[model samples]
Target: MINKIVQNMAEAMAGVKDGMTVLLGGFGLVGQPNNLVDALIETGVKDLTVVANNAGGGTTGLTALMEHGRVRKLVCSFPRSNNTIFEELYRAGKIELEIVPQGTMAERIRAAGAGVGAFFTPTGVGTKMAEGKEVREFNGRKMVMEYALPGDIALVEAWEADRWGNLTFKLSGRNFNPVMATAAKTTIVQTQHIVELGALDPQHIMCPGLYVDRVIHIPYGDPPF
Candidate 1:
């Protein structure tokens, strides 16, 4: 098997290009892949469609990405947050947005990873969110058809990763990271700890090596080969 570890964040992010859709794994600021985000900023690719749970919480990370004019559109549940960066860019029409219900958003990413083509839900029924979308009734209740949200690349944060790419997440830090690891063509993870292949307990593992493509060490550590 080919080694999945890269020497630096730059190498980890070398595949990201302009006009690509990326799944950024996190909920609010928690679990956001800071090292990868920094690498993307340095890479300076633009016209991106970023999918995430929320816009970056503060004036850095995702906010800094917007300030640098990298993202063209955003698919997320909460666009408004601690920083006004997205707001200002959005108001000036500098960015595009699609607001989804939080639960629906999670399922959409999960559905993509699970190979589910489409599904119906009641989240956006009767609201503007359902505009121009197919709707139907099931068991006397209304549901809107939503498509899966697969991405060209997914950047996830994991608390620990085995040398072979199996990952385990920390408490709440697991937010969105597991599913995002499977929904993208390539998944690059920024992990806090890199353990030997058998170091992780099978029961504690949250994502298998089959889904993860690259393992990167945090604080910009050298590649773990």
Candidate 2:
């Protein structure tokens, strides 16, 4: 098997460049790829577009990238609560924000993974979320077709992964990791534990080796809480 494992977070983020779209996998502060995010900050690559559930709490998760003024756009569900920098940048006209509903955001990333261009849903109908989006009627109700979101890189957090890059996530942290893995050109996983090949059960693998291009073993850190 090809070894997708890297020495550290810096190696995991090797090819990421300026103005790239990155999908960060985590929900709030839980199961975030903090080490990789910090490494990206150190790289000083700017003008990033990050897609995630939230930016994490203030100085944590993707917010670190925002602090360095690296992020130019955020494609997220709700930014009002967790992201201070995002709010400031939006008000200052320094970044573009695309507000996707929670469910739709998940579905759109999944659609990208499945190689589908667009799909229709009733989640945002009759609201500002529906503005400028193509809407069609279905069974006496209106639904909008949202396009898929494919990224240049996917930064994911996993509970454990093998040297071959098969991964498993913990609980709710699995929210967008699996979908984002397949939807990105290069997928990097930051894992709490890196085991030998064949250690993880095939049935339990959340993301298979083919979708994952790199893995970083992050030593345990206090959960951003």
Query: Against the unseen true structure, what C-alpha lDDT does each candidate score?
Result: 0.87, 0.85
Task: Single out the weakest 10-residue window by summed lDDT for candidate 1.
Answer: 216-225
Candidate 1, lDDT over the whole model: 0.87
Off by over 4 Å in 1: 219-225
Give the number of the best model, judged by lDDT: 1
lDDT of 1 at 114: 96
Work out the TM-score per prediction: 0.94, 0.94
Clash counts per candidate, in order, are 0, 0
Please give, for residues 159-196, the per-residue lDDT of candidate 1 as tens digits: 88986789998877798999999999999998988888
Displacement of residue 188 (Cα, Å) in model 2 is 0.4
Clashing pairs in 1: none
